[model samples]
Target: MLRAHTVEDVRRAEAAAMADLPDGALMQRAAAGLAAAVVDLLDGAYGRRVVLLVGPGDNGGDALWAGARLAGRGARVEALLLADRVHAGGLAALRAAGGLATRDPDDLSAAPDLLVDGIVGIGGRPGLRPEAAAALARFPAVPVVAVDVPSGVDVDTGRLDGPHVRADLTVTFGTHKVAHLVDPAATASGALHLVDLGLDPDELGPPALEALQPDDVRALLPRPGPDAQKYTRGVVGVRAGSGTYPGAALLAVSGAGCGLVGMVRYLGPEHIADTVRTAHPEVVGAGRVQAWVVGPGGGDDAGSMLAEARADGVPVVVDADALRHVDAPMPGCVLTPHAGELAAMTGVERAEIEADPLHHAREAARRWDCVVLLKGHHTLVADPAGRVRVTTTGVPWLATAGAGDVLAGLVGALLAAGLEPYDAASVGSWVHGAAATEASAGGPLTAGGVAVQIPRLVRATLNPSGSRPLE
Candidate 1:
């Protein structure tokens, strides 16, 4: 799992580590790592024109020290000090190594190949200072390498309010920050590189956000035992689709039939049911199921389908149109909604939800007292108690029609396999994303194509050595 700690957590960890080290040792370690990353990005430091946007704090210190190292290695490093009070020691070191420092923006005759943003650290507010923003505007086309994080991003909240550096690559220290993984800020933070400070993971306590890796998902997957039979694995029931959207039922069942569960039982109109049976001949009509997936393309019949699914007293995956009928607490259910659907249910604007999805997803889970899966570029599965898992594995091709329908059925399969709502939603989302990536193969993707690719993706994940790459 990729765990993202808050700004406060990183501060505490840094302070603790600094206490054990000699004076300036920790900063040197960070600087060495930062310089190494920059050199790697430039292919070589020799003769590369590197510009540093220096600020007042330790973030600027890291960049100054790194600039010194780059200068020593033959890179022409120039620092534009954006703040009145800069890190004195770091500036001295850069000057000693033959790097140029200037307070003026137009001092440089030519733009550098790469821009380093050391304008603000994790401690600063969400918006950039006028000087820093102006300095950044001078080099509009240059690819940026942000120190720790892209300056001016809300480190803890992942919100981008005002002027902030858009880094092509951000070199983060120790653990991942919330801004690096969560969206909005994450969008500005192009690519990430972590530099370990040897901090204890146990000391960090719980993370603010967690993203599941392939190994983590592999461990969460359910495998049948020696004595397992078809019924022994688990059965998932689908109560989705209507006359108007018969394809929704087909898409959902396609995901359910990816072999995660023992059986798939879809309940809808006779014509649609027959269509589903024809598409997936292995599917059976409605019977007792361990879990239920309700309300994909359900239209006006969503309320009634939700009522019947609730009567079964099993864990349910509530999605699409059925999200509207959820008024009270649903302890064991998972509610999956896109930004617009969530906004409708909570009376907030879709734009508001998209701006800070982490906050809105958590708030919705708390409000409904159920697991909430807010689908987006980065899918978040937030539990009622406040834990969240963000799935960042999908390709942009996943925006096709009926994708959510496929995801709903996949989550229901995991729920039927006896995973908790949180685990089921997150794990299923991760797998769904991975399947989409495999399906896309750099071209347009279809909803049914995602379902077809699930088995291949899961096989490759669990058995990486011999399996083909999803790409």
Candidate 2:
């Protein structure tokens, strides 16, 4: 699992670590890691041009010290001080190591091969200062390596209010920050690298967010035991689509039948049922099921389908048109909603929900008393108690239609497989996104294609022979 802590938690952990160590120990560790990461980015330390955007706080100190290290290894490093008062000790060290420090950006003869952004730390508010913004604008094309975090992003909320440094790579110390895992800000953070600061995990408290890796998903997946039978493996029921949109039923059933559930039960209009059975002949008529997936192109009968599914007294994965009918959270229910659907449920504007997805998703989960899976670039699966798992495996090509329907069915299958609502949602989301990536393969993909790739992804995850485990 890739766990992300809040700014306050990181601060507390840092303070705890610093109390027992030397005054400059933590900074030295961070600087060493930062410099090493920069060297890797540059492919070598010798004869390379590097620019440091230095600020007033410890973040700037980290950059200055890292620049000193680079200068020691023969890199042409320069620090463009953006603050009125910078870290004096770090500046002195840089100067001693043959790195030039100047308040003027124009003192640099040319654009450096890479830019190091240490202008603002996690505690800094969103949006860039004038000087920092100007320096970034000057070298717009240069790739950036952010220390701790990309400056000007909300470290706690992962929201980008205005101009923020978009880093090609972010080297975070101690642990991952909320901005590194959540969306909008996460989109700005290209790739993430963690450098251990040796902080005590006990002081960090619980993580603000968690992301499931392949191994985590593998461990959570419901695999058949030696004595397992078909009934013991679980069955999932699908109540989706109608004559108007029979494709939704086919797609939803396709996802449910991707080897997660032992059997798929179809419960819809005869025409849609026929279509589902034709596409997925293994699907049987409506019968007893461990879980039911409702909504998703149910058209005029979505509310009825949801009502019937709830009456079954089994876990349900609610999606699409059925979301509007949800007043109170049902027992063992997972509500899947995109921004617009979430807006409708919460009575917030879609733009507002999109702007602060974490807040809204949590609010909806708490208000409805269910696991709310808010689908987007980074899918959020939030439990009623505010625990969240972010899915970060999909590509941009997954924005195709009927994708959510497929996800709904996939999650329902996991629910039937005996996973709790939170685990089921998180695991299903990870698989859904991974399957989308597998199907896309750096190109366009349809909803059906994503569904079809689920079994393949599951096979690979269950039997990862030589592949590296997801971190």
Candidate 3:
């Protein structure tokens, strides 16, 4: 899993590391890594011209140290101080290593091979200062590499406020930060690289969210014994589809992983169920089920399955129409709501949720006492306890009509296979996103196409080899 820590958490980790290490040791290590990355970017560092935009903090210190290293490698490097005062030791080290420091406004327009943005780091707001903004505007087309988190971005919330520098690449120290994974600011970070400072995991604490790796998903997958039959794997009951939207049920069942699902039980309209059976012969009429998936396209009849699933102690995935039916707290329930549905569920405006999705998702999860999955660019899975996971993989092409249905079905399969409500939702979201990426391949894709690609993508995740293991 790829873990991401908050800005405060990263600062705490840095403090702990600096306590044991020498005064300038961590900055030196950071500079070394930064210098190596800059050198690799250029075909050869021999005679390349590099410009450093230095501010007044450790970020500027890092740039000065890196500039000194580049000078030793025979590169023409210049540091332009954006502030009156800079890191004293860093400036002295740069001058001692045969590097030139300047405060010339005329040289700001000079087009260099690379520009290093050291104006601000994690301890910065969204907007840039007047002078800093003017300096950045002088070179509109330079390829810039950011030292830490991109300057002028909300390191904690990932929200954008005013003028911000757009970097072609960002090299962050320690582990990943919240801005690197979240949107708005994340869009400004073109490419990312992590520079490890040997931070302790305990100091970093548990990550805010993580994207499950293939091995992680494989380990979490359930297995059946030799004597196991169809029912042992688990049955997923789906109460989706109406006369108006029979295709929703078909797409949901299509995306449901067949290997992990013992059988699919249909509990809806006869005509719609017949259509589902014809498309997928393995599905049968409703009977006993281990889990339930409610409201893909059941516009009005979505609420009936809540009592049914609750009484049976089966985990339930509620989506679309069922979102409107979430009247009270239901145990073992996972509610998947888009911005509109979330607004309806919370009786708040949709714009409010869109403006600040992290806060809204957590609120919904708490109010309903269930797992809430908020759909957006970064899909957030929040449990009733307030823990959250964000999925950042899927392509924009996956935003089609039946896409939510497919995701809902995938979660149902996970729930049936024995996972906690939050894990099943989060892992299902990760797989759904991965499958969409595999199907799109940088091109356009339909919801049905994403569902069709699930089996191959899921199998690849489980075994990685060409063959599947015995269940």
Candidate 2, residue 368: the lDDT equals 87
* lDDT over C-alpha atoms for residue 312 of model 1: 94
- Residue-level lDDT of model 2, residues 364-430, one tens digit each, is 8888899999999999999989999999999999999999889999999999999999999999999
lDDT tens digits by residue: candidate 1, 1-471: 999999889888888888999988778888999999999999999999999999999999999999999999999999999889999989999999999999987886477999999999999899998878888888899989999999999999888899999999999998999999888899888889999988877777799999999999999988777788878789999988898998999998988888988999999989889999999999999799999999998999999999999999999999998999999999899999999999999999998898899999999999989999999998999998899999988999899999999999999999998899999999999999999998999999999999999988888887879755454
Residue 336 in model 1: shift from native, Å? Answer: 0.3
Query: Residue pairs in steric clash, candidate 1?
Result: none
Better of 2 and 3 by TM-score: 2
Candidate lDDT scores, in order, read 0.92, 0.92, 0.84
Q: Ten residues in a row with the worst lDDT in model 2?
A: 462-471
Mark the regions of model 1 whose C-alpha exceeds 4 Å error after superposition. 467-471
Q: Can you tell me which runs of candidate 3 are displaced by over 4 Å?
A: 96-100, 305-308, 465-471
